[model samples]
Target: MKDQAKLASDPADWSIVETVDAVCAGHASALEVTQAVLDRIARRQPVLNCFIRIDGDRALETASGLDAARSAGRTQGPLHGAVLAHKDMYYRAGLVSTCGSEIRRDFVAQTTATVLDKLDNAGAVDVGTLNMSEFASGPTGHNLHHGNCHNPWNPDHITGGSSTGSGSAVGGRLVAGSLGSDTGGSVRLPAGICGAYGIKPTQGRVSRHGVMGLSFSLDNVGPIARTARDCARMLSVIAGPDPMDTTALPVPVDDYEADLDAGVTGLRIAVPKTYYFDDISPEISKLLDSALAVFTSLGAKIVHVDLPHHDIIGALGNAVGSSEQCTLHDFWHQTCPEKYAPLIRARMQAGFGVTAVEYLKALHLRSSIARAVSDAAFGDADVMFLPVLRFPVPTLSETDVGDGAGLHEILGSINHCTRPINYLGFPALTVPCGFSASGLPVAFQLAGPAFSERRLFRFAGAFEAANGLSDCVPDLP
Candidate 1:
């Protein structure tokens, strides 16, 4: 093993697995690793604006305790001493969870989130809360509350959101992994745009108890990390049925890391014939083709299929999501509507016109739509492939539609490829595929049937092994 100081000297170069192995085996003390990360965060946070808070003192104290336990010969979990940050939504008892809104700027949680509790029990350290879209409403990463999170690749460009901080922080190597919720494209979009790996577990795969609610019917919790294996490790720790969240699926959680090295030798990957590719730019299309070529070279078969419901899925998903958002913020809408950013407030009000019958109709059709799409998409394939963004990563100025006449259309366009999956309750993984003409990252999403996260991870792992894109990180100034 390398000298403890030398190895821990640059925490950015270490993966979550490598960090854990070093801390557990005494190659580096947890406190030393934590200090390295704190130093890195200190340097990067000012430019990236990724974190809403920096809990350095608490993180160091916790890491010191973990080191003492290791000296006492206590067994450590897989995460041991890995430092992580999460979108400012997950609740920790007695701690402020801003949720990226002035409405709850000082809101302290009464109970801890189930996912955070699980990660804590697994020996991970929570360094702080990452910035996010106010109330997780906007898809463009614009938070009038906490300044927009800048992309590490180009500070002038936008870091896709509402998981803006998670993606920026991880891509900047401030942390190896972080938790981000996906309501529409929160997890996948930021990760894809920022050149990292993230997975939106199937709806109900991870418990949402004590997490801020966005759209109950569409909200999902997942992790964004530097590599597929890191994302897999975090997912394995946080996914499972919980007594606190009755919506969490009751099935046994699969050992996500056990099948990571299993390559996609004979896997069938479906490519959509329409909708997803409609507005894709030539550069992005070329990159997607190159990615497909890489898969073919690896012995994976790419099959083209005409996915059903391309025309209505987006609108239906919006209906369901907006309706639920309105319901959750009903009181706030009435009392302090002025507190919300105009764009978000208008977005929430879009639900006001949804007749009860219309909302019910959307809910009633969810299962049927999911089944039909699954049959069409996965009927002859193991998983479906789509681009995370149809165009190059946009700059903050380019996407800052604000409360204009085109707000809905702009926001809708940004999340077109990802929201439908939430409606279908399927798992999707985003892996960096290439860089765009502007030098920003481009990525592809692999989605599978409900609760098929293992397959998504397996497919992503193979791509990461082949392209080595996961090893790529933006040069931070």
Candidate 2:
């Protein structure tokens, strides 16, 4: 093997695929890689505040075991030797899953998340848990409990919620990849703002067993990684039917990485004529236009689609999600209201006011709305392209709108670009298209019909390969 110190330094810059290849080839041992990752995390965590917990000892132990197995002539899985972390919400039996809140600050899980089990089987090393929004509420990464998760690009900028640390850690190169949950825009928002690739798979594509619930109807589990292929590798391993999570669809999981190399030859990408871009800033618009140009250059056709029901989608989605969240936190909200952050409490209270009629109506209309929107969007296209953020990345101070004053407006506007897709239960992938003038990242999300993750991966991979932006990392020290 190469010098241990040199190997460690280089693997911090390696993609998940590269890390796996090197470890499997015996070019580097898993122990060395885990140590390198821990060292990087130690240096970066204080500045970024991305991790809620760092299980260094556990990670090294896991890595050493993998190395021993490999030395014994045993084969490893796809993610063998790939060091990863996750949102603090995903449970591991007997481990404390804070869910980024003081409410469950010391709460120990009785069972492990299905996704974590699958990752272990795939040979991924878990270093620790990342920070996130309390109870996965809010879109601005304002965690009054665990401290806000800052953007790696600039510590002052917000790192989109509630999968804040997943995005920050992955983009900061502290880990190879991370698993994050998205109720509305949690996964895509963070990944986009941090200049990484994240995919919110179809509602039931990945099992949610042992994961904290925000809005069961809308919550999705996905991965954020440096490249589309890395995201694909994680998704392929974590996605599939789980007997533990009845909500997981029985449909067969597609080979998400299989068609990644296949360019978007004649694929049609739909651009909505209204709603999505209604309030976008000129700077963001230009970047998206350039991204479209890149897609066009790669042989994909861009079509203007008159998407249906854009006006009511966000409101309806919020109603369903809020009601569900309130239902889950009703007891604690009623008794221990003081434990929650003001903004999170206020956000949850909106759910209580949503009557059963409104809640049922929202749930009842989901199927019809999804069908109409999907038909309109996909009638002549393979996937619909939309902005992840309508404006440039905002500073933490600007978006730290506390509980009572201006919370709804700020949170609503921040999540405007991603909520609609969650409402429709479609899959969307966040691809970093370019950087903003302020040096923050801007991204576009490509959304496709339910269970179309493979198609989204292919398109995103092609764009990433062409633009070569996925290789860009934040200049954090």
Question: TM-scores of all models?
Answer: 0.98, 0.98
Per-residue lDDT over 1-477 for candidate 2, one digit per residue giving the tens place of the 0 to 100 score: 244553465677788888888898898889988998999999999989999999999999999999999999874699999999999999999999999999999999999999999999999999999999998887888898899888999999999998999989998889989999998899999999998999999989999999999999999999999999999999999999999999999999999999899999899999999999998999999999999999999999999989888889888998999899989999998899999999888888988899999989989999999999999999899999999999999999999889857889888888898999999999999999999999999999999999999999999989988999966778877
How many clashing pairs does model 1 include?
Answer: 0
Lowest summed-lDDT stretch of 10 residues in model 2?
1-10
The residue-by-residue lDDT of candidate 1 on 1-477, one tens digit each, is 355664745765688888898888888888988888888998899999999999999999889889999999974698999999999999999999999999999999999999999998888888999999999987777899889899999999988989999999998899989999999999999999899999999999999999999998899999999989899999999999999999998989998887778988898999999999897899999999999999898899989999888789888887898899999999999999999999889888989789888898999999998999999999999999999999898889988887899988888888889988999999999989989889999999999998888888888888888898765667875
Whole-model lDDT values for every prediction: 0.90, 0.92
Instruction: Show model 1 residue runs off by greater than 4 Å.
Output: 1-9
- After aligning candidate 1 to the native by TM-score, how far in Å is the CA of 254 from where it should be? 0.8
Q: Residue 354 error for model 1, in Å?
A: 0.3
